[model samples]
Target: MKQYCQSILIFFLGLNLAFAQNKTENVFIITTDGFRWQEMFGGVDTTILKDDKFVRNRDRIKNAFVGKTAEESRKKLMPFMWDTVAKEGQLYGNRWAGNKVNVMNPYWFSYPGYNEILSGYADDSINSNDKMYNKNITVLEFLNKQPKLKGKVAAYSTWDVFPYIINDKRSGIPVNSGKDLVQGNLTEKEQMLNEILKNYPSLASDRHDFITYYLAKEYIQKNKPKVFFLSFDETDEFAHEAKYDEYLFAANTADKFIGDLWSYCQSTTEYKGKTTFLILTDHGRGDKIKSQWTSHGQKVSDCYQIWMAAIGPDTPALGEVKTEGQLFQNQIAKTAAKLLGYEFDNGKPVGREINSVKN
Candidate 1:
């Protein structure tokens, strides 16, 4: 009789575990550092393309990005985002359409912008891109602490400071950033990737965005993390170098990477109907007309302006929210947490989850 009762209990426990796994939702947050909303919605800025100071080969730039209309040009640059994401999800921060999204950080730069994004609040003390460890808890850390997601959360970033920003040592989350060698038992393909990364010529001080994307994809395929974050830095680096052509190219390539990620999630059984993607940027650059397009700081006008897009099982296919109200970057953390069926309470006041994505 005891043996029979033990068998029954085991059966019930199995059922409960299965139910929990089925209810688990995945969230992937992707950020392109310093990418502007203007080019995101309107496509390559022709004004900057024509300026000899920014564009070295005006005709080549025109042929590559310029079209008869802004819509055509944008589509040409980011066909997947303009075609699939716009049709299947929601996009915000088109200032001309009166939909605005801005960062809450007083300092319009990488660390502060990223902190506001992950922590659900801006820290005035974190004003620089220093290597100091983040004091406040991030949404990623909160998710990592959950029973279902512990040891199943990972971050891959092009910038090296991500370890400090996410406090990887304290959170105990695997962070593959900068030129750090890929660790763990990697698949053959992933091993090849690591070998290539080691041999590839140095394009930027940080690892290339392609390496970051592939490494994150490999990790996702191997470990199937419940939550993931990928940050690409080429856009910001190229812009700061005043290489407009390379910036546009990098932006287009990043769009392709995003499309590929969405496709992979939809094709995989674990994430097919359960994954949500929140795509955004840390901050926006200055105006092209002001010749400060390559810069973003407190002194730069419109530097706070940023953009966000979401697509998933929970988000409605609203496509380009043009409402009058403004959205802040801090809201992203709560919105991401809400999508994964968790409340991101960091024991402090923060922005609420975005209403549009709270279905």
Candidate 2:
């Protein structure tokens, strides 16, 4: 343990000394809860669409998203990801193409996956989905501690547990999640939103992803935060409910949300060419058996596999990378921090920065 700590300290020292600062002064992280790499790369599953157990409106989804080739179909399914990011950014973890990204944690679930993504450490103790305050210091918290970035980091999620997952109380980063309303002076839009959300429909424990997106967008517009995070849950919620059509729609809608947010960032002065968008899934779903597509955990096969996409002034335009290599979820925290020229170190050994993303 002593040697390990020494190694980590030295690693970050060298990392900081050799760091190449990029143009990204800010970063926006967006995630689709439990979204799969398969659908992300191959488009909607036609076989599953035909099953009564899966889709609600087969013909409608077909007409809207399906196409003859994977390239064509994926373009229809998530137009912004295909048309824009594909041309201007990098997409990782298309397993069929040999590039892969996997969860470093043992448990293939939300909290553990997110912990790895945010903390850059996969604690085996974080094995549950309960509303427990995280002990680890996330990159957000690390940035929040910075003199220049204090009070400029914020996160929002559809899941009520986010306040606990992020440990907002301890980190001092505001996490507006679930049924929580905008505090302090509320905009007229915030007032209206709060009223509707008080009676808003939800799937089990999660509020609507669209609501979460808009709420976060309002905050982003209001504050122009240096580090902003949003996690949408409908894709995972619909999959858990066995509503395949809703899941696909959620994925497609998430694409539109990304496009909208990026468009806004480009139009705004604070974000324009100075911001980077980092996108990924909290976890991955099953794949070996068709019926297991809705399930994830330690028991689920291929649930460790995940995907990520990036767009920014510094990232090279390498869409859907076909190179044969592997990356882990733990690398993302440093990747996000490094985009803005920070070495994310919380005293634990983090996965090294993804060098490819720096260019």
Candidate 3:
């Protein structure tokens, strides 16, 4: 009887350890601004690739982005998503399969979309991409207010308006966005990055995503924040310029960047096995008319269609969800908070948590 009781005690302790290890402690919210579900799901649009108006260097685009079929093309475009995330996690908004994800906001542009995403509310007053401080509190702010997460939430974005979008002035979250970036107590790498920032050519007040990536990486290494948001903007910029070649290149490189981030997390002791990655776009571009792919706003049709993916120790490996379903961008905030074992509530009707994204 004594031996049997000892065995049961050890078994229960092992079960408790497993349960604790299964909980996700860190979350990464990554957004590729304005990347559409079409290119993400169907790969390269051959129609756009063939049009001389868009593809200036057919040889380069074909050599790099094109595949004989749409599936092959998309696999080449975002290998990390199709090959890794789809296999190990879940992907939504593949309209081809009727698994749809969209923005709850009426205005299908950057600012409104991001607001809906981080705040879980779509305030109509946030109608423009103007640098107006957000009136709503975001999941980041709510998380920072938590006793355990204070000073452990950070945001980095390629767009200048992020400070206003995240409302860093009020939230007190350290948001590093274009022009207003890291300062004081600089590491050697940070000093070089700031020097490069000074000489780099500006692109519509958007810092190059590469620079933003390095700065975020440095911060992640140093701070090990409980919550992190890294937003890349070049895909949207190149698309708006009608540069398909550059847009495809931007998407491809961003995939590599995401893969690098996940790998770093897995290798790091503080982050390994505890971090969850929730990847998606801020908004979508027009879909059917081909030319409309370059524009994303309330005026553009099908611009509300967006995609989302989640991978982590807690999320089951369901791969690309083929079952017919609907998800909204507003759900992201709650979903992110949920992963960290918190129910985000601030006297607001936040979007319901996406239970399917996790265990």
Candidate 3 per-residue lDDT over residues 194-229, each given as its tens digit: 888888956633778889999999999988898999
Candidate 1 residue-wise lDDT, 173-208, digit = tens = 888888887877778888887887789844754878
Give TM per candidate: 0.92, 0.94, 0.93
* Native-to-model Cα distance after best TM-score fit, residue 227 in candidate 3, in Å: 0.3
lDDT of each: 0.88, 0.89, 0.90
lDDT of 2 by residue, 67-186 (tens): 999889999999999999999999999999899999999999999988888999988999999999999999999988889898899999988888887899999889998888888888
The most accurate candidate by lDDT is: 3
Clashing pairs in 2: none
Arranged by lDDT, best first: 3, 2, 1
Sort every candidate by TM-score, greatest first. Answer: 2, 3, 1
Candidate scoring better on TM-score of 1 and 3: 3
- How far off is residue 203 in model 2, in Å? 3.2
Off by over 4 Å in 3: 1-22
Residue 327 of model 2 has an lDDT of: 91
Q: Which number leads on TM-score?
A: 2
Query: Of the candidates numbered 1 and 2, which has the greater lDDT value?
Result: 2
